[model samples]
Target chain A: MNIFARIGYAVMTVLAQLGRLALFTGKALAAIVSPPIYFRLILTQMMRIGYFSLPVVGLTAFFMGGVLALQIYLGGNRFGAEAIVPQVVVLGITRELGPVIAGLMIAGRVAAAIAAEIGTMKVTEQIDALTTLATNPIKYLVAPRIVAAVISMPILTLIGDSIGVLGGYIVSVYSLDFNGSAYLKNTADFLHSDDVTSGLIKAAVFGFIVALMGCYNGFHSKGGAQGVGNATTYAVVSSSILILAADYVLTALLFHK
Target chain B: MSTPKIQLIGVKKRFGSKVVLDGVDLTIEPSSSLVIIGGSGTGKSVTIKSILGIIRPDEGTILVDGEDITHINGAARDRVMRKFGMLFQGAALFDSLPVWENVAFGLIQGRGMNRAKARDIAIQKLAKVGLTEDVAFLSPSELSGGMQKRVGLARAIAADPEIIFFDEPTTGLDPIMADIINDLIVSTVKDVGATALSITHDMTSARKISDKIAMLYGGKIIWQGPTAAIDSSGNPYVDQFIHGKAEGPIKMAVKA
Candidate 1:
């Protein structure tokens, strides 16, 4: 085939796949609205996917905020604006750095784990077993993960933002030779509630995307060990890319205000 | 004398252009064992998967308890599944869960029984399968191949399912271990009074366990009769399969 034919075929193939995915998504949504919610399963998954993820997110945010503060001090000093460290740090962490960093980290950890767990289940016919047992696999498996990710991500982002801000605060007050009160005032002045809100909203959306990609990849996974490994790799890579893309779009829309 | 526990009528399934099953029909009587013998790629697994609704048939019906479950969904599917237990080709135990949890998976996860109660039943099932209580605390990966199959069997009967499916259950184990598992399956099925449907290439297993034996070739059953009559079924395909001879009506589908 010529270039035009090749391009057209690729586009058609992608369209076909997307249509199938949409249909599957509709089935999932239907399963969601149906009775027998499995609240206990949701709570169990929340503990595993969300609550347990705190330490890594906190540690990453703390160091990221600290390092960001130091970088801004050096960069701003070149322009005789070292005093802007706190304002820059707070805006950067609250609006961009905190959610994006925490999101990327979680996309790697949670996505891979969910894919592997579900993939193993798929290969062994446990998922099929559930279906035979008359349990809606969507409600029992997919819904819990999706709900947990959506609810837990915002909380994780909130905690991460606090730790990130504190990390910047420590650096600004100690190493940057700035008055603590002035630093606090600039941070408060530069950042509004919208910036923080947008970041948290992005975190929740990213969480859904992360969990969705993981479950989608793993649930459809084929072969055996290699198929599961591929699902894990695809989950992490795809979710990370999607997070970055989403961050840009959300930022452009939010910052336009 | 009772109605067949499972009846697959004119079942047809195709994957794209490749037809996996072409108008297949089968029946398994209650408390009786049926073994489907076929080659590796001749759709033995597809036949089982179709009955379970894991792979939907393009045409025909799968009936359990005289009810068609082929196109069924939702709570009805689960209700049907509760009556069925399966021992997969591999043990297929959840590695993250302890041995007892894996055994009690159906009881705890599907039925929502208390873990303590589920754990006690799991130990009993494990003991029935010849594993001790201490072995229940270990992970599935910690167990050997034979041990895992035993664990898988334990899980299958955990809920006292009315029917059981075993897929190549004896293929990977040593001869003695395979026979041991086969015997366990025979005794357990009898003990629980469960109908059994199995597929395997092992004629020894087929002859030992099944009262009725069917040979699947070219996506259809070529011959099916009592196990005692298999040797004299006089069908070339059945003769080739049970005798393990390659130079008859059965031809290997090698790429070369």
Candidate 2:
């Protein structure tokens, strides 16, 4: 094929994929609001996507906050503003790092899992089986995950923000020889409720993206095991990229003023 | 004559450049077993899926009980789908759910039956398929291929559907086990008075279970007759497929 033809083909493929993803998102959202909501399934998914994700999100947030504090201390020392460590860490964690890091981590963990599970179900005809049994696959499978993820992510981000701030406090008090009480006071003074809420809003959007990508890839998966494996990879890659891209867009929208 | 239980008129489907079903038409009478025999990629499954509304035909009309069901959605689609119970080629049991739940899935999820009531009916259906009560609580993964097929059969009959579709019901079973399943399918389908539509490349299973058989080749139903008349189909493709002949007009697409 010529270069022009190849470029055209690529554009068409990307457009087709985008259309499919949009359609899937619309259907999943519709299923979420419709009747016969599977509260049991949603609760089960919350335990899996939110409660179980606490450890990884907590650990990553703690280390990230500690590192951020150390870097800010070094940078601030040069400007004779060493006391800015608590303020900067709190602002960063509550506004950006906490939600973005938690979203990316869950994208890797939960998104990959949902894709592989649903993709396997597709290959094995279990999805078709659901259809045969008079159950809509979208309502039965996709909606629960999307609903649970949307509800779970903000809560996970909130917990992660707390842990991250505590990590910064630990580092400021011990490693940097700062006063613990003063550091807490500075963090509390600098952090606004708006900052925390904005991060949570971003978290909810990221959650939807992660679950949507997973379901879209998995539902379209064909062939066999190899196809399912590819879906899992695509789910993680697309969701992680989308999470980052959405973070930029959301950050601009939420914190622009 | 009375209207047939299921009808497909000029059903056509294509995946990319390859045409899977090319203007295929067939009619199935009520409470009769009809098996579609074909090669591996001969659109046998596609034909069944089209009728079941799993894969909509690009161009066609599918009718169930004289009602045009070619385009319906939501609750109407669910109501149409409730008439069907399918036994997938690989059983397709939910690995997460135990055998009894797999059987009761439709009753509880689709019809909103109480769980305890659905479980009782599930056990009863399992027994009808020669499966004991002990197997009900076991996960589908714990069962062998034959046992899984039995569970799938039980699930198909659980709701006492008006129409039952068996997609390669005995694809991977030993001859004895396959024959047993064939017998179970025939008897269970008879017991429920369901109109059975099965697709299989397994000629033995087809011959054993079906009262009438249709041959699908090159994306069309080339020949259809009663099971006893299949030997005299006179069509080369049907002859080649039924007798398992390699040297015939229907050449196997073996890549060099």
Which number leads on DockQ? 2
Residue by residue across B1-256, what tens digits does model 2's lDDT show? 8889999999999999888899999999999999999888889999988887889889989999999998888889999999999999999999989999999999999999999999999999999999999999999999999999999999998999999999999998999999999999999999999999999999999999999999998899999999999999888889989999988888665531
Q: Count the backbone clashes (under 3 Å) in each candidate.
A: 2, 0
Q: What is the C-alpha lDDT profile of model 1 across A103-169, one tens digit per residue? A: 8988988999999999989998878766654467788788888888888888899899989988998
- Model 1 steric clash pairs: A133-B78, A134-B78
TM-score (all chains, Cα) for each model = 0.93, 0.98
Displacement of the residue B155 alpha carbon in candidate 2, Å:
0.9
Candidate 1: where is the Cα deviation over 4 Å?
A1-5, A30-35, A38-44, A74-81, A252-257
Candidate whose lDDT is highest: 2
- Candidate 2 error regions (>4 Å): none
